[model samples]
Target chain A: MKKTTLFDIISPVMIGPSSSHTAGAVRLGLLAKHIYKNTPKKVKFTLYNSYAHTGKGHGTEKGLLAGVLGLDVDDRRIKDIFNSDIAKNIDYTFSYADNFKKHPNTVDMVFDDSMFVSGESVGAGEVAIRKINDFNVKLTGRYNNLILVYKDKPGMISQVTNLLQKEGINIAFLNCDRNAKGQEASMIIEIDGKMNTSIEDEILKIPDVYFVTYVEKLEN
Target chain B: MDTFEQLYKECLTKNKTIYQAAQENMAIEADISVDKVRSFALKSLFEMKEAIRSGLISKELSMSGMCGQDCYKVQQYYKKQNSMFGKLFEKIIEYALATSEENIRMGRIVACPTAGSCGIVPAALIAISEEYNCSEFEQINALITAGEIGRIISLKVALAGAVAGCQAECGVASAMAAAAVCQLRNGRVSQILNASALALKNVLGLTCDPVAGLVEVPCVKRNPFLAVHAITAAELALCDVESKIPLDEVVDAMGQTGALMSPMLKESSQAGLAVTKTGLKVQKQVFD
Candidate 1:
């Protein structure tokens, strides 16, 4: 069928030494980082299916640790990350899970904190960040602009877009997921433009917004 | 749009059969430039040497220079738990095992253009870079050249795990290695790609079936051999020995050969090492 996008079609940097282990682990880790934001006081990373059974062998444990530590997939620091100070901040464990919706290479990461996120590494370093702290959101790690976690309020979608439009930022793709009206919701806006700190600050000012995070594509 | 299909059509027209184009594209990311390749490769080499010097990667484990059972020009960095390669060697083994888990999770594996021999290219390239102090930008460029070579092989022969077994894995890795080396030597794109295709075509139809289905056995040990082969293949191609076989035709032959192979020959753990008494016993032990 349909031709996959560059991000969709090709991803050179992956878990390391292998696309699945190095790159996928990194993606899964990045998702973990995105959702958790601040390092988890403690991380009960249960590797379900393939992750739990083979995590330690695959460096998934170290990779997962590095991802939580906010390391890129290609960062050689990832190899040494386990011994770093950032690593000491969080306590971690690895286990496998057999049942999951996405892929066998699935990992169900649980952060023992107020906010949590879970994701799947489908393959080729492609990741689907499924749930963040129980808020139902699905996004590929390829989002180049802003990440919005908020409550589902009327006009909230356009409100976020208008702010970006006024800032001279072009929206490449906008994905929004709402669990229930007036409850919790999430939006991932991929922009053709870079986001400065002001854009992030303005978004956080919104009443229903919980928190905001932005990742630059070239950073990886 | 038409230009995109040109690569695919050439692969098919020349009788070169590949696993999937979408998969091959995984190696063509924007960051994988010539400079990046040199940086990564040299960094990898430097790291390997540092590990050895600092007693991280172990001399026995890292001091690979052996010919193995299957291929003639094969070289392995370390034996399976033999010698005093010690902790670092053990760590590498552990990392090799984890790679399988990573592959299963990541949706589209490039195999770095190879599913079976995926670990070798990166390991070797990175290890070499580490030992030599190459920059990241340089490593990325070498990788780009290697990726192009791998793509050429996908067009020329097979990069699949099942077709040529570990030969395809290690063999193509060597080919990619050769291309990378050629590029490092300031060779042009055509020379690098040709070298890669030649390296792969020369070893087409190697089989899979890791002993006991573990990424260890031949998997872990095979990397160094491919790493060296990559060097040799690059050197040979650089010397301008005409292989005569167009890259596409050879890849097609690899595909046909793979299709003709018994299921055991694939990564299925059914044949070869998987059937040996020790293989069966180890497999049973793992499951038990």
Candidate 2:
């Protein structure tokens, strides 16, 4: 029910056997790439349910790799990604699972043997980044956002938002998810507009905020 | 914010056309100028044309080899016999087939509402524009009108076959194409909305049953069929034939119909034609 754009309805020229399986797979890869903030030397994809069953016929695998390699959805090179030079440099493997608990079109992108970002192709080429590592977080790329992984503690939210208030940035939406009390937690704050590297640096300067990722808004 | 009635009232209050209101609405939403929205739209239009051009020539099968160059066959057939439906009809069918075939082959395509339903709007708009010599601005207006209709309906139902069956994809796409073509021919707001209503009402409970779970078979061929379907609705609306149910009510009905629809028929490919004997055989031939 958001103010849907003509682009949302009529655009995003893409390579397709499907929008959700192909384009949306590419977007999930892109989001995973953004979250890691670096290309992994090794990666593994765990596709679940429908994606696991029909991904190959749909070029879902190609789109997923092409996206992590920084290809846009429309790139014709997506169809030949297995033979593409970009995918050759990295170690990548795909495993399928049947998980009714997950959405029908869902995957977990495990980067560099450790970082795991789970997401779902909700529908219509739209996606949601649901969990990072083990924390339940929401990153939809609907806005310019920050994902702060820190030791969970009181006053961390206020500390982060107070810095934004000083920089004249407004928090449009925010969510906090933690592993346990006083342990590893993440604050996913979707902000109004562009935030420079200085904001990330400022957030990192906080005592318990060890990691920060500035996620750009999604193109599709 | 979701219904056609709101958009209609907004259009009337501002004395702006549906296209104008859509443009203004997009500009406001994205915090950009209307020119940028129009520019982006024109880019999509060009890409749609490019997809058709490529598809008319290529014979690339889908990854599963279930569908591929059916469009080329249609073009060849048209050249030989000339279509019984006449020039515009031939153009509509050929362009629709061309674009959807292009999509299944992994060629570039604009997802007008979605990739599975991409062919309808462009097939209608391009056929008319090429035949009638409509200007680029007029084409943009038609696309904007189509987009607005899609946007309003999407507010009620997510425009995905997985969410709401083919009614949300090809069915809504047919309605969007009707609105676009109606606008291109200078039908006013009322007629445009009615065209959309008629197209949607006719396709209620249309399922998403692509054999082999690919956007081929029914999807590619459905493009040409539904592109022509839009024409019927547009023609009736042009003659001042109003829909029994209004546009807003039609969209609401579509939403309710989608909810009432069995999940098996809504792109799960578990029931309907997807699980037919031939469908299972193709699924085996492709995936097994």
Candidate 3:
């Protein structure tokens, strides 16, 4: 069993109606925003199953938008956020559907024209980033995370991790998902501490590394 | 990651209490000073109190308008009634409703195990602490004790309606609150464990049937009901009452029962009260 912290039991002092719907929505949105790495000019949210069915009641849609706008999970302004000036800067639309295959409280985020990120509000204000664009990967945003979209080639993994080892940043977890043999692959590494800009530049310097993103740990 | 039994035995051998063992173990696991743990627990207590303080004055409903203002209604009823449960009883009900209502309106709250069951622990701890005049330090210890109880149960079952329904959420919270109240009265380790087991064992099969898939309706009302329920368990435990099954075994039973539950009865809202004619109508009215 995973160690359940007193913080996990008693904290996260969050804005609520539902933790999974509201707080988890904010978290997923924050992670997607981190992956996108910019203030989105336009966005579409595809809420699935229970999120579609009961999201409005729980203010999940509001929570998601507030999160994308860079609001914290405990921000009181999220309740009336749609009317806020910050919301006026973005173009956002919501659609609902039931995909029996997806988790009940799942959302697919479409950012700009090309960035598509899908995530799930698993429960109890815990979220997991399930996919980025068409690439399937796993990220929980619990730790400082490094994400890489690169060619599937030998030594690529070692080269990326070797940079971290040189920087003395301990790797907490690492995951790799590839689209095809010797083709495009996504690698997500959760590290214990920060990987500075120099480390990023070093990783990007590797051959066949298409893109790199560093996502900071979510704020408590 | 010692089991509760292992922790208890260690406490007895070391001549330390269960809460002390919990605090020491947490201090090690989190790599923080024990005082830091105490301070962190106090932070949660303050958050819980803030929720109650704000919740008491607000009359906001949920976004769906299916629930809310019931806390206000309870406050009004308490003001006029003179007979039954009296002030402390009135405080428990009113505070529970208040905190839960605040949660629905998206106010900041300490989710004791969860947002849906946030009200129960605060209701019990605050009421008893205030009436008995316990210090904030004592209150933190009680809350930490409660947190450890909740933590142990959650190890067996994920404390969410989607996973194990309200039994794991609200039921476990009631158990947590029971342990807290036991600590407030200076109950022994055995008594505290028994109180938690009694509270949990009674609500073993309780379903997480939030109507219209919202945490309001039964969830908000259930907070006060279970907040009061913790009292029965704690009172019995203080008298040296024992649960036939141990606390760990009771938690294990809860996990087993959750595994055996119908998918619809969980937070999916596909069955139970969520499927009632009124529930379906509420869903349509709010969503459609």
On residues B124-187, what C-alpha lDDT tens digit does candidate 2 reach at each position? 9999988889999999999999999998898878898877899999999999999999999999
Q: Count clashing residue pairs per candidate.
A: 89, 0, 0
Structure candidate 2, residue pairs in collision? none
C-alpha positional error of residue B87 in candidate 2 after TM-score superposition, expressed in Å: 1.7
lDDT, candidate 3, residue A119? 96
Candidate 1 falls in which docking quality class? incorrect
Candidate 1: Cα lDDT at B252: 63
Estimated TM-score per prediction? 0.64, 0.98, 0.97
Question: Which model is ahead, 1 or 3, in terms of lDDT?
Answer: 3
Task: List the DockQ of the predictions in order.
Answer: 0.08, 0.81, 0.82
Per-residue accuracy of model 2 over A104-179 as CA lDDT, tens digit each: 9999999998899999988778888999988888788778889899998889999999999988898888999888
lDDT of each: 0.56, 0.89, 0.90
Looking at model 3 chain B, report the run of 10 residues with the lowest lDDT sum: B1-10
Number of clashes found in candidate 3: 0
TM of chain B, each: 0.61, 0.98, 0.98
Put down candidate 3 lDDT per residue, B1-288, tens digits, no spaces: 446797678878899876788888889987899998888898989989999999999997778887779888888887788529789999999899999999998898988989999999999999999999999989998999999998888877899887888999999999999999999999998899999999999998899887778898789999999999999999999999999999999989999999999988988788999899998898788777
